[model samples]
Target: MLSRRRFLKTAAASTLCLTAAPAILRAKNLNSRLQIAGIGCDGKGWSDIQEMSTHGMTDLVAFCDVDLARTEMVHSLSPSAPIFQDYRELFAKQGDKIDAVTISTPDHMHAIIAIEAMQRGKHVYCQKPLTHSVREARQLSNLATKSGVITRMGNQIHSHAVYRNAAKALQTGMIGKVKQVQSWCQSTGHGKSGFIDRPKTNAPIPKSLNWDLWLGVAPERPYGLQDVYHPFGWRDWQDFGNGALGDFGCHILDPVYTGLKITAAPISISAKSTGMNDEVWPAQMTVHYVLPGNDFTTDGNLEITWMDGGLRPSLQGTHIPPGTALPSSGSLVIGETGTLVIPHYAPHVLYPSPDAKANVEKFVAEPSLNHYHGWVDGCLSGQQPSDGFDYGGRLTEAVLLGNIAVRFPGQKLEWNADQLKVTNLEAANKWLSRDYRSGWKLPETV
Candidate 1:
């Protein structure tokens, strides 16, 4: 047998050779770029492209949209990239050429597109409030696990270092046991009332828009100037979108969920809304969710309240400093010992006292990272994404349940997590999963 020193030298040399060999080979393989495709090339989808391309190794292979004008516009920007009207055709024609897909369609189409892409073994980056309904969220989450494809939901707040650091602080008990969280969004309604009764007219579909395909997976309805392309304001409609809560809840409330790790379904959900009748979207709303308390203590409750459309709670005498503009969208966490305040769409600052200057130095600033780059890195490395389907599904469920509450405001909604059903109201249960139009069924994975 070889001496101990001689054997150790041989093993170390072999390890070094093996590690260096991969680096040498990777240098030769530098030509390989991640070929990515974008569906729904307007609105946030354009932003997704800009972010993904920042990594310098991603080639925008294709752009797909029902609107020809949007696809043309994206094609103009990426002259070398191919364009397609139907996403299915685009995938079929270029599946081998593409490495990943980013979906930024309306809520109703999120599950169908994302599920199909994942089934094809493609990594996915889907926009926030992950799905149109609670069932879709759960379905997508399970499918992501089964497919073994890297996935991320578009709750970009998780990518913010401040959000992560704040979560870490909360987890490490910096703020004591968090008992309550208040999250809100203040925005005007889409003002769809006056246009509701307009009679259907047989206007020619614009050359730039494939009107028939734009209404994918949704009920067939006549196309109108207000309905398609340009403004792309279908988000206010119940059939196509989940309204404001579904739009912003994922971004605003995501930090709280990240910090608390509150994965179990809400024990109860209740909503208070204005102008319930003759309204597809609530003029203003407030939703309350009851969650399990901190693990360190027993017999405690954590309440998360959501306010929107200029409807905010009484924050009088709170730790939020005077003269600081109260954020239109953000979270406030109330712990037993103190409070933590995060401003809307900005980095959070710890509030140790009501005075602006107290304990100012203890506040640690967090770095901001590109959310799209995080997903791309995870896709290439096989690591789990920061805001993966598991976290996103739970977040979507909480927000979509708020939509359910708005349908029948003031009624206490009982949720059965295991069964994934609303136990109290049968009429409300119907809204949990919608009927898909023919040829648009969301793919089911075994």
Candidate 2:
């Protein structure tokens, strides 16, 4: 078996030649199955693995997770596949056999694992937000382009009929030239872990868990009781996850980005929050983004407002009728002619009742494609999907930038995307990326 250092060196060398052709093209049979591995094998990870397994052209060869107790489901699905506590071990041992990897690990570990896998010419299907840091998102996208491999972000709803239709409607001028957008989710930033601060008492680590492995890139901290920092609780912490905006922004803002063709980075970002501490995110926050306008948007910078923690956009200007209620989580596209309300996972609605309703049928609704199967198909055919890292990275960058704005509540930080710098606040720029723990440091990127 290769040592971790040697594995990285080998992977780096392979990346140099990988740009010439995709790894999938090496299969003698063009129709041969893809040998796959699951880096995280429970919760959303299990669902992703289960769905990909049903694709018929993908085979699970290995499983890796920090906690052995949480891997029961993946083991039952692939009884013969070997399981490893550390993802590096699986990569080092089965590097040659694995054709692709599904990274359902916490937001913190996503970039490191995906970068290593892609460097080895392995396709990656990583969960959103694509990386914990904006810099990581940009670097990961650059590497994905350089490596020439199939890639997809695990924002599964991107394939849903509702979002597809919403995006199509905007492009088709159903709501002529969107003037502004308001998007929000009900999820809070720090409530999932049920703690506003780190636990004062340290609990003994479970034998089934590798606490060191679980902490991956974040600074070292003691393992607390169940649900404190393990399993599903990391979403509340600053180090391990991206809080509410990081968690749901990609899903909620996907259609807006797709519809507006927002390729340029936001020119400025300002935010306000209930409050925040060093360890956890605020419970409620609001961010404003000014992005360059496109053909789908009105001239001048297009404004987007984001809110969370039960904050909903006002319907006064949306023309949705005064008594009509908004969805708990969704976006409203304010346009010159009409407003489109897109509920998360539900059908979209248009305002100005009768007239807009008539045009709904004129807008084509795309058929919902199986997201997992789409990634597998992309791997086999070497055709990059619509939500590949290129698009995902840009979306994730904007989402994470909103989180950075959360730190300085009322300041409007001027963003220079080319330099990845916050021109107005040098201190804010520091939050763009983080200092990785000593042993988990990744190679420097441009």
Off by over 4 Å in 1: 1-32, 189-203, 227-230, 277-279, 296-299, 320-325, 353-364
Can you give the lDDT of residue 367 in candidate 1? 80
lDDT of 1: 0.73
TM-score per candidate, chains pooled: 0.86, 0.92
TM-score of 1: 0.86
Tell me model 2's lDDT, rounded to 2 decimals: 0.86
Residue ranges of candidate 2 with Cα displaced over 4 Å = 1-31, 353-358, 444-446
